[model samples]
Target chain A: MHIVDGALSNPVLIGGGLLAASGVAYSLKKLEPEDLPRVGVLSAVFFVASLIHVPLGFSSVHLILNGLLGIILGWAAFPALAVALLLQAVFFGFGGLTVLGVNAVNIAVPALLVYFLCRWGLSAEKHLLAKRVADGLFLVFFLITIWAGFALYQLYQVEGGSWSVTVNSVSLILFSGVMAYGYFLYRRGILSVAGFWGFLGGSLSIFLTAVMVAISLALSGEEFGKAAEFVIVAHFPVMAVEGLLTAATIQLITKVKPELLHAVR
Target chain B: MTQVLGEVSRSWTLDKHQQTQEAFLQSLDPRVRLLVCVLFSCVVSALHDMMALTLALGIGLGLSLFARLPIWTTVRKVVVVDSFILVLVLTLPFTMPGEVIFSFWGWEASREGLFRAAEVGLKANAILFSLMALIGIMEPSVLGHALYRLKIPIKLVHLFLFTVRYIDVFYKEYKTMRMAMKARGFVPRTDLHTLRSIGYLVGMMLVRSLERSDRIMEAMKCRGFDGRFYILDTMKSGPRDRIFAVVSAVTLLGLLAVGYL
Candidate 1:
């Protein structure tokens, strides 16, 4: 979810813009000559993915794929997603040009986190269980970080707003349940050989979607419980579907070219 | 899904309504237009007062009219594009703390929220309309050239051009894959089985895309391609572009002054 032009306060915009610029600068410096085409191709993939909608019951939602991009491209996801977003702003006006920097950071930062936490374990093919655990841990940790009021402060200046004990406790329980389910899938040996990859992918999709919705609503000044209700409850079905798709995709890749996973790591 | 695909492809079409319209905005230098648009958006963002926002919006509307862009369609497009922002505005009245005009279920519509929402709405609409009137007139190639001339990094520009050029090709590939899945009796449902199949579809697309990228790299290298991308459209900022710049700057500054009052 993008914060449109003039929607955010000036300070947040400038701060986000500067941070995003530095991330891009670092990415550019880190990029090798051989990596240019890969980055460009992945950029096109990300751009096209948004156009492919996944049908929910009545309405459909486009794919974000930020997590997928992060796992594959690492820091390169920053520049890659940034270019795709720039085009989205120019062609469709889905996001404003002025807010491009902040929008890029909002999506790409989590991707970096995914890369840092999951890279080693995922690369070690022997540690499939470790990879799933890493993904689950990172996701739950990520949710806790956001739901703990960090997003409310970063995105909006909402004061005197507290998550009701009831809402917080409920969300915490639900999130833990998700984490436990992910672990169960890993242990049950669901899909034979790379089932855990699918689990990781699905969990990442759900985690990213929840975080995106929470921040978007928070920035719009919605209270924590309301945002949580919409993200956790309203988007629950979408999360489940997204996870399954993500897992399947990961499984296919692991079957066809398992080295691709190791390559990114 | 089909609707979104069509809309995405349609947005990239080179020949649109803005091309046929012979307007002053169409004639301005692309670089100047880009700069002015950025400056205008920043100015709009800075203004807090509705009076100033309304004045800014008036200028945007005037420019759109002068450019001969269809008014109704432009308004419709702005509304559609800013739907999320509109939703944010909807929350303002009930969420913000101020003197309440209406209260329901413990939520109050405060004057401050209403005022803030209007400020955001006016600013957002003004920026969108102005962008449509100004930068929307130029071709993507021309805009890429302008960005190059404006000293944006060459690699960034190259990445942008590649993404734009190949998006259609990849979209076609994605559609074909989806069609193949459908042929195989795949129906997307809320179940894990269907979701897994869709995942295979996405993975298959990525693998193909990566392979295609390698081929593209080889082709480019065969043609003696370098890291630097050369912009074909050579645009120079002439006196007319300068005039547009001066006029726009003066108008924005004047609005800023009025906003301060």
Candidate 2:
């Protein structure tokens, strides 16, 4: 998740920048010429991946895939993240050079976690190919499941709501349910008319919100609006639509490329 | 979208790229330019006045023109830096409570904030342009050497160098991954699906990169890379370079007074 320029102080930016630079340096130090190409390519994929946004709550959350990046780059995910973010900042102006450090930390840490889990749990199977593949699959499930929970926990903290993380059925429904839904949507629609449905459904909420916002503004006169009205009438639906769109878009990508779901070592 | 993204090439074979780089080095001492860039950033950052910020931007623009770097390129480069400052600017007229010029969602936009935004906008633009020129002039290799000579840890220099060199490598790897995905007749599934796919994609990439690193280290061992790096590069600092450094430093110091005091 981007810290959205000016989300924190300049000092934070500098501190984050230092960390990002150091993290990248650390990643680079461990790199070989051969590894360099893969890092660069995957970072580019990560770059492209983030461009595809899905609605999530009040905001559209693009996939950072940092967890996956970590699984590949290990600590080296830092440079991959930094460089990609730098490109994004330069090209899309999504983030700025000043805040590159902070953004990298946000994305790279989770990626590192996935990388470690993958290396230890999957890569350990040197002798048996079958065992490695199976174990890698298991590890991927474990990593992604944990990542889902972690993201929710983070969401709770950011929302100033109950810090209480209910990891049970409700929370599971909130987290795993979405993943399952996307899986279902993806598998069922590899092609056919489903693609349009997928795209339509993916962006439907955002489009709906726009319609509603437009209608509301048309109905209600400006200058008569209050804070409570904005939240109750405007904010909540935008958030819900955002979440739905995010879910749908992510599902679309998964459906198209199943290998992205391959278990990592 | 592709065109807007600019020409995607890491290796520049153009003579101009080399000439521009040489011209920069020919102009001033590396240490002085680095200090001026860093110091100017500091002074401009601390002050939140529009007039002062504009002055800085004007100065930066003037410098760029003098340097003979295309004005459009500088603008593009400056915008990258500007995004960081604009985030702050965009918030100013809304968050800071003052005379209400505009209000929405129970939030009031203040007159002061607008002016403050202007100040920050100009200041940030100026600082960004200056920094951009500094980077434009100095080759990443030269920077690594300079920093190393200036007592920055050798590890840091090596790290920076490796990062710069491998940046293109990562880009290439990423393209392959995308092609691989596309070959599967995959269309992106929307939300969590996309995240999951991306998650796996990034994970696979990281794993591959590290594996490649191991092989590379082994390869290097087959050659010779005793940890301490020997610089084959030798840059002679001239009297003109020393004078250039002094002038920039004095200029920055003078600019600080004009901006701050």
TM agreement with the true structure for every prediction: 0.84, 0.59
Question: What lDDT tens digits, residue by residue, belong to model 1 across residues A1-265?
Answer: 6667867667767776888889988887777666677677767777787777777656676777666677777888888888888766765666776777878887888777766755655556577576556666656654763464344343333433343343444444554565466557656766533445445544554566467545644664442234333354434444445555666676777778775564332
* Model 1 stretches astray by more than 4 angstroms: A128-182, A192-198, A201-241, A262-265, B1-21, B70-76
Worst 10 residues of 2 chain B by lDDT: B4-13
DockQ of every candidate structure: 0.50, 0.10
DockQ-based class of model 2: incorrect
| Model 1 DockQ (Cα-based) | 0.50
Supply candidate 2's per-residue lDDT for A189: 49
Model 2 lDDT tens row, A105-129: 6566545654544444332335355
lDDT tens per residue, model 2, B30-133: 65666666677666665655566677788777666665555575566566556545545665676555799888665578897677567656655665566555
List per-prediction Cα lDDT, in the order shown: 0.68, 0.50
Choose the strongest candidate by lDDT: 1
List interface RMSDs for the candidates, in order.
2.7, 8.1
Provide the lDDT at A206 for model 2. Answer: 30
Model 2: lDDT equals 0.50
